[model samples]
Target: MNMSVPFSLLFTLIILFLSVLISSTSAKKPGDASQDLVRSSCVHASYPNICLRSLSSYSGPANTPGEVAQAAVKVSLSRARKASNYLANLRSQSKREQGAFHDCVEQMGDSVDELSKTLSELKHLRSGSFRWQMSNAETWVSAALTNEDTCLDGFKEVTGKVRSDVKRKVTNLARVTSNALYLINRLDQSRQKTP
Candidate 1:
Protein backbone atom coordinates (compact mmCIF):
# COMPACT_ATOMS: atom_id res chain seq x y z
CA MET A 1 0.00 0.00 0.00
CA ASN A 2 1.21 3.59 -0.80
CA MET A 3 2.24 5.64 2.20
CA SER A 4 -0.17 8.48 2.95
CA VAL A 5 1.31 12.06 2.35
CA PRO A 6 2.36 13.99 5.52
CA PHE A 7 -0.32 16.58 6.38
CA SER A 8 2.30 19.21 7.43
CA LEU A 9 4.18 18.90 4.10
CA LEU A 10 0.95 19.35 2.06
CA PHE A 11 0.08 22.49 4.06
CA THR A 12 3.58 23.88 3.52
CA LEU A 13 3.31 23.35 -0.24
CA ILE A 14 -0.11 25.06 -0.37
CA ILE A 15 1.18 28.00 1.65
CA LEU A 16 4.25 28.32 -0.58
CA PHE A 17 2.07 28.32 -3.77
CA LEU A 18 -0.27 30.99 -2.30
CA SER A 19 2.63 33.20 -1.25
CA VAL A 20 4.12 33.10 -4.79
CA LEU A 21 0.77 34.02 -6.38
CA ILE A 22 0.20 36.90 -3.94
CA SER A 23 3.76 38.23 -4.40
CA SER A 24 3.48 38.19 -8.20
CA THR A 25 0.15 40.06 -8.13
CA SER A 26 1.47 42.65 -5.69
CA ALA A 27 4.64 43.25 -7.76
CA LYS A 28 2.73 44.37 -10.87
CA LYS A 29 3.69 47.94 -11.87
CA PRO A 30 1.00 50.64 -12.33
CA GLY A 31 1.20 52.28 -15.73
CA ASP A 32 1.57 56.03 -15.75
CA ALA A 33 -1.89 57.69 -15.96
CA SER A 34 -0.58 60.57 -18.03
CA GLN A 35 0.76 58.32 -20.79
CA ASP A 36 -2.63 58.43 -22.51
CA LEU A 37 -2.77 62.25 -22.48
CA VAL A 38 -2.23 63.74 -25.91
CA ARG A 39 0.47 66.41 -25.91
CA SER A 40 1.20 68.37 -29.06
CA SER A 41 4.79 69.52 -28.76
CA CYS A 42 5.87 73.03 -29.67
CA VAL A 43 5.82 73.58 -33.43
CA HIS A 44 7.99 76.71 -33.24
CA ALA A 45 9.64 78.78 -30.56
CA SER A 46 7.70 82.01 -30.11
CA TYR A 47 9.90 84.56 -31.85
CA PRO A 48 9.12 88.27 -31.70
CA ASN A 49 7.80 89.16 -35.15
CA ILE A 50 8.38 91.80 -37.88
CA CYS A 51 12.11 91.25 -37.64
CA LEU A 52 12.07 94.00 -35.01
CA ARG A 53 14.42 92.17 -32.73
CA SER A 54 16.60 91.34 -35.67
CA LEU A 55 16.61 94.94 -36.84
CA SER A 56 17.10 96.29 -33.33
CA SER A 57 19.95 93.98 -32.47
CA TYR A 58 21.47 94.47 -35.87
CA SER A 59 24.93 96.00 -35.31
CA GLY A 60 26.22 95.00 -38.68
CA PRO A 61 25.29 98.38 -40.14
CA ALA A 62 24.00 101.54 -38.57
CA ASN A 63 20.88 101.66 -40.75
CA THR A 64 19.49 105.20 -41.12
CA PRO A 65 15.77 105.78 -40.85
CA GLY A 66 15.46 106.78 -44.51
CA GLU A 67 17.83 103.96 -45.41
CA VAL A 68 15.54 101.59 -43.61
CA ALA A 69 12.53 103.00 -45.45
CA GLN A 70 14.34 102.80 -48.75
CA ALA A 71 15.45 99.28 -48.09
CA ALA A 72 11.94 98.19 -47.14
CA VAL A 73 10.33 99.91 -50.15
CA LYS A 74 12.90 98.31 -52.36
CA VAL A 75 12.10 94.92 -50.96
CA SER A 76 8.37 95.40 -51.43
CA LEU A 77 8.67 96.71 -54.97
CA SER A 78 11.01 93.88 -55.82
CA ARG A 79 8.39 91.35 -54.75
CA ALA A 80 5.69 93.04 -56.85
CA ARG A 81 8.05 93.17 -59.75
CA LYS A 82 8.76 89.47 -59.36
CA ALA A 83 5.06 88.64 -59.30
CA SER A 84 4.59 90.68 -62.43
CA ASN A 85 7.54 88.91 -64.00
CA TYR A 86 6.08 85.50 -63.10
CA LEU A 87 2.75 86.38 -64.71
CA ALA A 88 4.60 87.54 -67.77
CA ASN A 89 6.55 84.30 -67.93
CA LEU A 90 3.39 82.23 -67.46
CA ARG A 91 1.62 84.20 -70.16
CA SER A 92 4.48 83.49 -72.54
CA GLN A 93 4.43 79.79 -71.70
CA SER A 94 0.65 79.50 -71.95
CA LYS A 95 0.88 81.03 -75.41
CA ARG A 96 3.21 78.15 -76.34
CA GLU A 97 1.22 75.35 -74.54
CA GLN A 98 -2.35 76.02 -75.76
CA GLY A 99 -4.18 72.81 -76.98
CA ALA A 100 -7.55 70.89 -76.82
CA PHE A 101 -8.37 70.57 -73.10
CA HIS A 102 -5.28 72.60 -72.54
CA ASP A 103 -6.98 75.44 -74.41
CA CYS A 104 -8.61 76.28 -71.06
CA VAL A 105 -5.19 77.39 -69.90
CA GLU A 106 -5.67 80.48 -72.00
CA GLN A 107 -8.54 81.37 -69.70
CA MET A 108 -6.34 80.46 -66.76
CA GLY A 109 -3.68 82.64 -68.25
CA ASP A 110 -6.26 85.39 -68.40
CA SER A 111 -7.16 84.69 -64.80
CA VAL A 112 -3.49 84.96 -64.02
CA ASP A 113 -3.56 88.26 -65.80
CA GLU A 114 -6.40 89.42 -63.55
CA LEU A 115 -4.68 88.15 -60.46
CA SER A 116 -1.41 89.75 -61.50
CA LYS A 117 -3.12 93.05 -62.12
CA THR A 118 -4.71 92.97 -58.71
CA LEU A 119 -1.36 92.10 -57.21
CA SER A 120 0.23 95.06 -58.93
CA GLU A 121 -2.47 97.38 -57.64
CA LEU A 122 -1.98 95.95 -54.20
CA LYS A 123 1.74 96.40 -54.54
CA HIS A 124 1.31 100.09 -55.25
CA LEU A 125 -1.47 100.34 -52.71
CA ARG A 126 0.84 98.90 -50.11
CA SER A 127 3.33 101.68 -50.76
CA GLY A 128 0.73 104.41 -50.20
CA SER A 129 -0.90 102.52 -47.36
CA PHE A 130 2.37 101.90 -45.51
CA ARG A 131 1.96 104.92 -43.23
CA TRP A 132 -0.90 103.32 -41.34
CA GLN A 133 -1.98 100.00 -42.80
CA MET A 134 -3.58 97.05 -41.04
CA SER A 135 -5.09 98.19 -37.78
CA ASN A 136 -4.39 94.59 -36.89
CA ALA A 137 -1.64 92.52 -38.55
CA GLU A 138 -3.72 89.41 -37.80
CA THR A 139 -6.63 90.85 -39.72
CA TRP A 140 -4.14 91.77 -42.42
CA VAL A 141 -2.89 88.19 -42.34
CA SER A 142 -6.46 86.93 -42.76
CA ALA A 143 -6.93 89.25 -45.72
CA ALA A 144 -3.72 87.94 -47.23
CA LEU A 145 -5.15 84.44 -46.78
CA THR A 146 -8.25 85.53 -48.66
CA ASN A 147 -6.00 86.84 -51.36
CA GLU A 148 -4.28 83.46 -51.36
CA ASP A 149 -7.63 81.67 -51.75
CA THR A 150 -8.51 83.92 -54.63
CA CYS A 151 -5.17 83.27 -56.31
CA LEU A 152 -5.44 79.49 -55.81
CA ASP A 153 -8.86 79.18 -57.45
CA GLY A 154 -8.79 77.66 -60.96
CA PHE A 155 -5.03 77.32 -60.58
CA LYS A 156 -3.28 74.14 -61.63
CA GLU A 157 -0.30 72.48 -59.94
CA VAL A 158 2.04 74.96 -61.55
CA THR A 159 0.92 78.34 -60.22
CA GLY A 160 0.35 77.09 -56.68
CA LYS A 161 3.84 78.36 -56.01
CA VAL A 162 3.21 81.59 -57.86
CA ARG A 163 0.08 82.13 -55.76
CA SER A 164 1.87 81.32 -52.53
CA ASP A 165 4.87 83.43 -53.40
CA VAL A 166 2.65 86.35 -54.21
CA LYS A 167 0.91 86.06 -50.87
CA ARG A 168 4.18 85.79 -48.98
CA LYS A 169 5.68 88.86 -50.61
CA VAL A 170 2.56 90.91 -50.05
CA THR A 171 2.27 89.83 -46.44
CA ASN A 172 5.93 90.44 -45.77
CA LEU A 173 5.67 93.94 -47.18
CA ALA A 174 2.67 94.70 -44.97
CA ARG A 175 4.51 93.48 -41.90
CA VAL A 176 7.64 95.48 -42.63
CA THR A 177 5.64 98.61 -43.22
CA SER A 178 3.79 98.21 -39.97
CA ASN A 179 6.99 97.84 -38.06
CA ALA A 180 8.59 100.85 -39.74
CA LEU A 181 5.57 103.07 -39.14
CA TYR A 182 5.39 102.02 -35.53
CA LEU A 183 9.04 102.88 -35.12
CA ILE A 184 8.46 106.25 -36.70
CA ASN A 185 5.57 107.00 -34.40
CA ARG A 186 7.61 106.01 -31.40
CA LEU A 187 10.47 108.25 -32.45
CA ASP A 188 8.10 111.16 -32.98
CA GLN A 189 6.57 110.63 -29.54
CA SER A 190 10.02 110.55 -27.95
CA ARG A 191 11.03 113.73 -29.74
CA GLN A 192 7.87 115.47 -28.57
CA LYS A 193 8.51 114.35 -25.03
CA THR A 194 12.14 115.55 -25.02
CA PRO A 195 11.69 118.89 -26.82
Candidate 2:
Protein backbone atom coordinates (compact mmCIF):
# COMPACT_ATOMS: atom_id res chain seq x y z
CA MET A 1 0.00 0.00 0.00
CA ASN A 2 1.34 3.37 -0.96
CA MET A 3 0.06 6.52 0.75
CA SER A 4 1.25 9.75 -0.84
CA VAL A 5 -0.10 13.29 -0.50
CA PRO A 6 0.25 15.84 -3.28
CA PHE A 7 2.65 18.67 -2.50
CA SER A 8 0.09 21.25 -3.62
CA LEU A 9 -2.55 19.84 -1.27
CA LEU A 10 -0.14 19.85 1.71
CA PHE A 11 0.95 23.41 0.89
CA THR A 12 -2.69 24.54 0.71
CA LEU A 13 -3.46 22.98 4.07
CA ILE A 14 -0.46 24.67 5.67
CA ILE A 15 -1.47 28.05 4.22
CA LEU A 16 -5.05 27.63 5.43
CA PHE A 17 -3.92 26.79 8.97
CA LEU A 18 -1.50 29.74 9.04
CA SER A 19 -4.17 32.13 7.81
CA VAL A 20 -6.60 30.99 10.50
CA LEU A 21 -3.96 31.44 13.18
CA ILE A 22 -3.02 34.89 11.94
CA SER A 23 -6.58 36.01 11.67
CA SER A 24 -7.36 34.90 15.20
CA THR A 25 -4.28 36.58 16.59
CA SER A 26 -4.70 39.83 14.68
CA ALA A 27 -8.47 40.26 15.02
CA LYS A 28 -8.46 41.60 18.57
CA LYS A 29 -5.98 41.87 21.39
CA PRO A 30 -6.48 40.26 24.79
CA GLY A 31 -8.01 43.39 26.33
CA ASP A 32 -9.19 45.20 23.23
CA ALA A 33 -12.82 44.92 24.23
CA SER A 34 -12.16 46.56 27.55
CA GLN A 35 -10.10 49.27 25.88
CA ASP A 36 -12.84 49.88 23.38
CA LEU A 37 -15.30 50.22 26.20
CA VAL A 38 -13.04 52.77 27.82
CA ARG A 39 -12.73 54.76 24.59
CA SER A 40 -16.45 54.72 24.00
CA SER A 41 -17.10 55.76 27.55
CA CYS A 42 -14.81 58.76 27.14
CA VAL A 43 -16.45 59.97 23.96
CA HIS A 44 -19.18 61.82 25.83
CA ALA A 45 -16.86 63.33 28.41
CA SER A 46 -16.57 67.11 28.52
CA TYR A 47 -12.85 66.75 28.07
CA PRO A 48 -12.63 63.60 26.02
CA ASN A 49 -8.91 63.76 25.36
CA ILE A 50 -8.15 64.24 29.02
CA CYS A 51 -10.60 61.56 29.92
CA LEU A 52 -9.11 59.07 27.48
CA ARG A 53 -5.54 59.85 28.45
CA SER A 54 -6.14 59.77 32.18
CA LEU A 55 -8.22 56.59 32.11
CA SER A 56 -6.14 54.70 29.56
CA SER A 57 -3.98 53.15 32.23
CA TYR A 58 -7.03 51.75 33.96
CA SER A 59 -8.68 50.40 30.81
CA GLY A 60 -7.70 46.80 31.20
CA PRO A 61 -10.56 45.96 33.52
CA ALA A 62 -13.01 48.57 32.29
CA ASN A 63 -15.45 46.22 30.64
CA THR A 64 -18.57 48.20 31.46
CA PRO A 65 -19.79 51.77 31.83
CA GLY A 66 -19.74 51.42 35.58
CA GLU A 67 -16.18 50.15 35.52
CA VAL A 68 -15.10 53.04 33.25
CA ALA A 69 -16.83 55.52 35.54
CA GLN A 70 -15.02 53.99 38.48
CA ALA A 71 -11.73 54.33 36.62
CA ALA A 72 -12.46 57.99 35.91
CA VAL A 73 -13.23 58.64 39.56
CA LYS A 74 -10.04 56.87 40.58
CA VAL A 75 -7.99 59.03 38.21
CA SER A 76 -9.74 62.14 39.49
CA LEU A 77 -9.03 61.13 43.06
CA SER A 78 -5.38 60.47 42.40
CA ARG A 79 -4.91 63.83 40.63
CA ALA A 80 -6.83 65.62 43.37
CA ARG A 81 -4.52 64.14 46.01
CA LYS A 82 -1.48 65.25 44.06
CA ALA A 83 -2.92 68.72 43.54
CA SER A 84 -3.70 69.00 47.24
CA ASN A 85 -0.12 68.06 48.13
CA TYR A 86 1.26 70.51 45.59
CA LEU A 87 -0.86 73.29 47.04
CA ALA A 88 0.27 72.40 50.55
CA ASN A 89 3.90 72.53 49.51
CA LEU A 90 3.40 75.85 47.76
CA ARG A 91 1.58 77.19 50.82
CA SER A 92 4.51 76.24 53.06
CA GLN A 93 7.06 77.86 50.72
CA SER A 94 5.16 81.12 50.23
CA LYS A 95 4.83 84.00 52.74
CA ARG A 96 3.09 86.58 50.57
CA GLU A 97 -0.04 84.73 49.45
CA GLN A 98 -0.60 83.02 52.76
CA GLY A 99 -4.35 83.34 52.78
CA ALA A 100 -4.82 82.39 49.16
CA PHE A 101 -2.46 79.44 49.42
CA HIS A 102 -4.12 78.23 52.59
CA ASP A 103 -7.56 78.51 51.07
CA CYS A 104 -6.51 76.74 47.89
CA VAL A 105 -4.88 73.95 49.82
CA GLU A 106 -7.98 73.48 51.97
CA GLN A 107 -10.24 73.39 48.93
CA MET A 108 -8.02 70.87 47.15
CA GLY A 109 -8.17 68.70 50.26
CA ASP A 110 -11.95 68.85 50.13
CA SER A 111 -11.84 68.01 46.43
CA VAL A 112 -9.68 65.00 47.12
CA ASP A 113 -12.04 63.82 49.83
CA GLU A 114 -15.06 64.18 47.57
CA LEU A 115 -13.35 62.31 44.76
CA SER A 116 -12.44 59.55 47.19
CA LYS A 117 -16.04 59.30 48.28
CA THR A 118 -17.19 59.17 44.65
CA LEU A 119 -14.75 56.38 43.91
CA SER A 120 -15.83 54.44 46.98
CA GLU A 121 -19.47 54.76 46.06
CA LEU A 122 -18.80 53.67 42.47
CA LYS A 123 -16.79 50.69 43.61
CA HIS A 124 -19.54 49.55 45.95
CA LEU A 125 -22.48 49.92 43.58
CA ARG A 126 -24.95 47.05 43.41
CA SER A 127 -27.43 46.29 40.66
CA GLY A 128 -30.30 46.48 43.09
CA SER A 129 -29.32 49.97 44.20
CA PHE A 130 -27.29 51.07 41.21
CA ARG A 131 -29.44 54.13 40.53
CA TRP A 132 -29.22 55.45 44.06
CA GLN A 133 -25.52 54.68 44.25
CA MET A 134 -24.88 56.35 40.90
CA SER A 135 -26.76 59.38 42.12
CA ASN A 136 -24.47 59.56 45.13
CA ALA A 137 -21.45 59.18 42.89
CA GLU A 138 -22.65 62.02 40.67
CA THR A 139 -23.22 64.32 43.62
CA TRP A 140 -19.82 63.65 45.13
CA VAL A 141 -18.04 64.10 41.81
CA SER A 142 -19.84 67.39 41.22
CA ALA A 143 -18.78 68.53 44.65
CA ALA A 144 -15.22 67.57 43.85
CA LEU A 145 -15.34 69.63 40.65
CA THR A 146 -16.84 72.53 42.55
CA ASN A 147 -14.12 72.36 45.15
CA GLU A 148 -11.51 72.50 42.43
CA ASP A 149 -13.11 75.57 40.88
CA THR A 150 -13.21 77.26 44.26
CA CYS A 151 -9.51 76.53 44.67
CA LEU A 152 -8.85 78.28 41.38
CA ASP A 153 -11.11 81.13 42.31
CA GLY A 154 -8.93 81.86 45.34
CA PHE A 155 -6.12 82.95 43.04
CA LYS A 156 -8.25 85.24 40.87
CA GLU A 157 -7.32 88.48 42.58
CA VAL A 158 -3.64 87.59 42.83
CA THR A 159 -1.12 88.46 40.13
CA GLY A 160 2.13 86.88 38.88
CA LYS A 161 3.65 83.40 38.91
CA VAL A 162 1.93 82.01 41.97
CA ARG A 163 -1.51 82.64 40.61
CA SER A 164 -0.57 81.44 37.14
CA ASP A 165 1.03 78.28 38.47
CA VAL A 166 -1.87 77.53 40.76
CA LYS A 167 -4.34 78.27 38.02
CA ARG A 168 -2.55 75.92 35.61
CA LYS A 169 -2.49 73.05 38.09
CA VAL A 170 -6.00 73.60 39.34
CA THR A 171 -7.35 74.01 35.83
CA ASN A 172 -5.84 70.71 34.75
CA LEU A 173 -7.28 69.07 37.85
CA ALA A 174 -10.69 70.59 37.18
CA ARG A 175 -10.67 69.40 33.55
CA VAL A 176 -10.01 65.84 34.65
CA THR A 177 -12.69 66.09 37.31
CA SER A 178 -15.10 67.45 34.72
CA ASN A 179 -14.36 64.51 32.46
CA ALA A 180 -14.93 62.13 35.36
CA LEU A 181 -18.25 63.75 36.05
CA TYR A 182 -19.24 63.46 32.40
CA LEU A 183 -18.33 59.77 32.37
CA ILE A 184 -20.36 59.26 35.52
CA ASN A 185 -23.28 61.01 33.88
CA ARG A 186 -22.91 58.79 30.82
CA LEU A 187 -22.92 55.77 33.09
CA ASP A 188 -26.07 57.00 34.73
CA GLN A 189 -27.69 57.55 31.38
CA SER A 190 -26.70 54.08 30.29
CA ARG A 191 -28.30 52.60 33.37
CA GLN A 192 -31.47 54.53 32.75
CA LYS A 193 -31.78 53.11 29.24
CA THR A 194 -31.58 49.51 30.42
CA PRO A 195 -35.04 48.07 30.86
Candidate 3:
Protein backbone atom coordinates (compact mmCIF):
# COMPACT_ATOMS: atom_id res chain seq x y z
CA MET A 1 0.00 0.00 0.00
CA ASN A 2 1.62 3.28 -1.10
CA MET A 3 1.41 5.92 1.59
CA SER A 4 2.37 8.78 -0.69
CA VAL A 5 -1.24 9.53 -1.59
CA PRO A 6 -2.37 9.70 2.02
CA PHE A 7 0.70 11.68 2.99
CA SER A 8 0.09 14.09 0.17
CA LEU A 9 -3.46 14.54 1.37
CA LEU A 10 -2.29 15.19 4.88
CA PHE A 11 0.25 17.74 3.71
CA THR A 12 -2.36 19.52 1.69
CA LEU A 13 -4.69 19.61 4.68
CA ILE A 14 -2.01 21.18 6.81
CA ILE A 15 -1.30 23.87 4.23
CA LEU A 16 -5.03 24.55 3.89
CA PHE A 17 -5.38 24.95 7.64
CA LEU A 18 -2.48 27.36 7.73
CA SER A 19 -3.92 29.27 4.80
CA VAL A 20 -7.30 29.61 6.53
CA LEU A 21 -5.71 30.85 9.71
CA ILE A 22 -3.61 33.38 7.83
CA SER A 23 -6.57 34.62 5.79
CA SER A 24 -8.74 34.99 8.87
CA THR A 25 -6.09 37.11 10.50
CA SER A 26 -5.70 39.25 7.39
CA ALA A 27 -9.38 39.88 6.71
CA LYS A 28 -10.34 43.52 6.97
CA LYS A 29 -11.95 44.00 10.34
CA PRO A 30 -15.01 46.23 10.63
CA GLY A 31 -12.65 48.86 11.96
CA ASP A 32 -10.40 48.57 8.93
CA ALA A 33 -12.90 49.49 6.21
CA SER A 34 -14.70 52.36 7.91
CA GLN A 35 -14.07 56.11 7.57
CA ASP A 36 -12.20 55.91 10.85
CA LEU A 37 -9.63 53.70 9.16
CA VAL A 38 -9.77 54.80 5.57
CA ARG A 39 -6.37 55.29 3.94
CA SER A 40 -5.24 55.85 0.37
CA SER A 41 -4.96 52.99 -2.04
CA CYS A 42 -2.43 53.24 -4.87
CA VAL A 43 -1.65 51.49 -8.14
CA HIS A 44 0.41 48.54 -7.01
CA ALA A 45 -0.60 46.44 -9.94
CA SER A 46 2.16 45.01 -12.21
CA TYR A 47 2.74 47.07 -15.33
CA PRO A 48 3.57 45.76 -18.83
CA ASN A 49 6.67 47.90 -19.38
CA ILE A 50 8.75 46.01 -16.87
CA CYS A 51 7.79 42.73 -18.48
CA LEU A 52 9.26 43.71 -21.84
CA ARG A 53 12.76 43.99 -20.40
CA SER A 54 15.00 41.03 -21.23
CA LEU A 55 15.68 38.38 -18.62
CA SER A 56 19.29 39.58 -18.56
CA SER A 57 18.09 42.88 -17.17
CA TYR A 58 16.21 41.16 -14.38
CA SER A 59 19.04 38.84 -13.47
CA GLY A 60 21.45 40.06 -10.79
CA PRO A 61 24.19 38.61 -8.65
CA ALA A 62 22.59 36.58 -5.86
CA ASN A 63 24.73 38.16 -3.17
CA THR A 64 24.95 41.73 -4.41
CA PRO A 65 21.98 43.98 -3.75
CA GLY A 66 21.90 46.21 -6.82
CA GLU A 67 19.40 48.68 -8.19
CA VAL A 68 16.54 47.05 -10.14
CA ALA A 69 17.74 43.55 -9.20
CA GLN A 70 20.14 42.50 -6.49
CA ALA A 71 19.16 38.94 -5.62
CA ALA A 72 18.14 35.89 -7.56
CA VAL A 73 14.65 34.47 -7.17
CA LYS A 74 15.69 30.84 -6.93
CA VAL A 75 13.35 29.73 -4.19
CA SER A 76 11.86 26.27 -4.42
CA LEU A 77 8.65 24.84 -3.01
CA SER A 78 10.45 23.20 -0.11
CA ARG A 79 12.18 26.44 0.86
CA ALA A 80 8.88 28.23 0.63
CA ARG A 81 7.38 25.63 2.95
CA LYS A 82 10.10 26.19 5.49
CA ALA A 83 9.56 29.93 5.31
CA SER A 84 5.81 29.48 5.86
CA ASN A 85 6.43 27.29 8.86
CA TYR A 86 8.74 29.86 10.32
CA LEU A 87 6.17 32.59 9.79
CA ALA A 88 3.34 30.45 11.22
CA ASN A 89 5.36 29.96 14.39
CA LEU A 90 5.82 33.71 14.88
CA ARG A 91 2.62 33.71 17.02
CA SER A 92 1.28 37.15 16.14
CA GLN A 93 0.78 37.80 12.43
CA SER A 94 -0.82 35.84 9.64
CA LYS A 95 0.79 35.72 6.22
CA ARG A 96 -1.70 34.72 3.59
CA GLU A 97 -0.04 32.35 1.14
CA GLN A 98 2.69 32.33 3.70
CA GLY A 99 4.85 30.15 1.52
CA ALA A 100 4.36 32.01 -1.72
CA PHE A 101 4.43 35.40 -0.03
CA HIS A 102 7.78 34.67 1.54
CA ASP A 103 9.20 34.41 -1.94
CA CYS A 104 7.33 37.51 -3.08
CA VAL A 105 8.48 39.66 -0.17
CA GLU A 106 12.06 38.52 -0.70
CA GLN A 107 11.76 39.74 -4.27
CA MET A 108 10.03 42.88 -3.01
CA GLY A 109 12.50 44.01 -0.33
CA ASP A 110 12.16 47.82 -0.33
CA SER A 111 8.65 47.52 -1.61
CA VAL A 112 7.95 45.06 1.15
CA ASP A 113 9.37 47.41 3.71
CA GLU A 114 7.18 50.24 2.50
CA LEU A 115 4.16 48.00 2.22
CA SER A 116 4.75 46.59 5.68
CA LYS A 117 5.14 50.02 7.19
CA THR A 118 1.96 51.21 5.55
CA LEU A 119 0.07 48.14 6.69
CA SER A 120 1.48 48.46 10.19
CA GLU A 121 0.29 52.06 10.34
CA LEU A 122 -3.11 51.09 9.07
CA LYS A 123 -3.22 48.40 11.73
CA HIS A 124 -2.37 50.87 14.48
CA LEU A 125 -5.13 53.17 13.36
CA ARG A 126 -7.73 50.42 13.51
CA SER A 127 -6.56 49.07 16.84
CA GLY A 128 -7.09 52.39 18.50
CA SER A 129 -9.64 51.86 21.26
CA PHE A 130 -11.62 54.84 19.96
CA ARG A 131 -12.68 53.11 16.79
CA TRP A 132 -15.91 51.14 16.65
CA GLN A 133 -15.34 47.87 18.44
CA MET A 134 -14.55 44.93 16.28
CA SER A 135 -14.25 41.37 17.46
CA ASN A 136 -10.74 39.88 17.35
CA ALA A 137 -9.17 43.29 17.57
CA GLU A 138 -6.51 41.98 19.88
CA THR A 139 -5.89 38.99 17.71
CA TRP A 140 -5.84 41.32 14.74
CA VAL A 141 -3.24 43.56 16.33
CA SER A 142 -1.05 40.66 17.28
CA ALA A 143 -1.31 39.36 13.76
CA ALA A 144 -0.48 42.73 12.24
CA LEU A 145 2.57 43.15 14.40
CA THR A 146 3.68 39.67 13.58
CA ASN A 147 3.18 40.30 9.90
CA GLU A 148 5.29 43.46 10.03
CA ASP A 149 8.15 41.55 11.56
CA THR A 150 7.62 38.63 9.27
CA CYS A 151 7.80 40.82 6.20
CA LEU A 152 11.18 42.11 7.29
CA ASP A 153 12.41 38.70 8.30
CA GLY A 154 11.11 37.01 5.19
CA PHE A 155 12.71 39.68 3.06
CA LYS A 156 16.04 38.89 4.63
CA GLU A 157 15.65 35.13 4.31
CA VAL A 158 14.65 35.11 0.65
CA THR A 159 16.93 37.86 -0.52
CA GLY A 160 19.93 35.70 0.46
CA LYS A 161 21.30 38.66 2.41
CA VAL A 162 20.82 41.12 -0.43
CA ARG A 163 19.27 44.57 -0.10
CA SER A 164 15.53 45.13 -0.06
CA ASP A 165 15.36 46.70 -3.52
CA VAL A 166 16.35 43.39 -5.08
CA LYS A 167 13.31 41.85 -3.51
CA ARG A 168 11.16 44.71 -4.73
CA LYS A 169 12.39 44.24 -8.27
CA VAL A 170 11.63 40.54 -8.10
CA THR A 171 8.08 41.30 -7.02
CA ASN A 172 7.77 43.94 -9.71
CA LEU A 173 8.87 41.41 -12.31
CA ALA A 174 6.11 39.04 -11.23
CA ARG A 175 3.50 41.72 -11.93
CA VAL A 176 5.14 42.55 -15.24
CA THR A 177 5.13 38.88 -16.17
CA SER A 178 1.42 38.70 -15.53
CA ASN A 179 0.80 41.80 -17.57
CA ALA A 180 2.88 40.38 -20.40
CA LEU A 181 0.89 37.19 -20.42
CA TYR A 182 -2.34 39.15 -20.55
CA LEU A 183 -1.09 41.16 -23.51
CA ILE A 184 0.08 38.05 -25.31
CA ASN A 185 -3.31 36.46 -24.89
CA ARG A 186 -5.01 39.55 -26.21
CA LEU A 187 -2.70 39.68 -29.21
CA ASP A 188 -3.24 36.01 -29.95
CA GLN A 189 -7.00 36.51 -29.98
CA SER A 190 -6.67 39.48 -32.29
CA ARG A 191 -4.46 37.52 -34.64
CA GLN A 192 -7.01 34.73 -34.71
CA LYS A 193 -9.67 37.24 -35.68
CA THR A 194 -7.58 38.37 -38.67
CA PRO A 195 -7.81 34.98 -40.37
Clashing pairs in 1: none
Q: Which stretches in model 1 have alpha-carbon errors above 4 Å?
A: 1-48, 53-60, 63-159
Give candidate 2's whole-model lDDT. Answer: 0.84
Worst 10 residues of 2 by lDDT: 90-99
lDDT for predicted candidate 1 compared with the true structure: 0.38
Could you list the CA RMSD of all candidates, in the order they appear? Answer: 18.8, 4.3, 23.2
Indicate which candidate wins on TM-score. Answer: 2
In the range 72-159, model 1's lDDT, one tens digit per residue, is 3333334434543554455323533323114333433443343343334323425345444323322333343344344434344434
Model 1, position 36: C-alpha lDDT score: 13
lDDT-best of 2 and 3: 2
- Colliding residue pairs in candidate 2: none
Model 3 clash tally?
A: 9
Which of candidates 2 and 3 reaches a greater TM-score?
A: 2
Q: Positional deviation of 131 in candidate 2, in angstroms?
A: 2.2
Name the regions of candidate 3 deviating beyond 4 angstroms: 1-48, 51-163
Give each model a TM-score: 0.31, 0.85, 0.22
Please write out the lDDT profile of model 3 over residues 97-149, one tens digit for every residue.
Answer: 35535543453343334333322332343324413322232233233334334
TM-score of 2: 0.85
Question: C-alpha displacement of 159 in model 3, angstroms?
Answer: 11
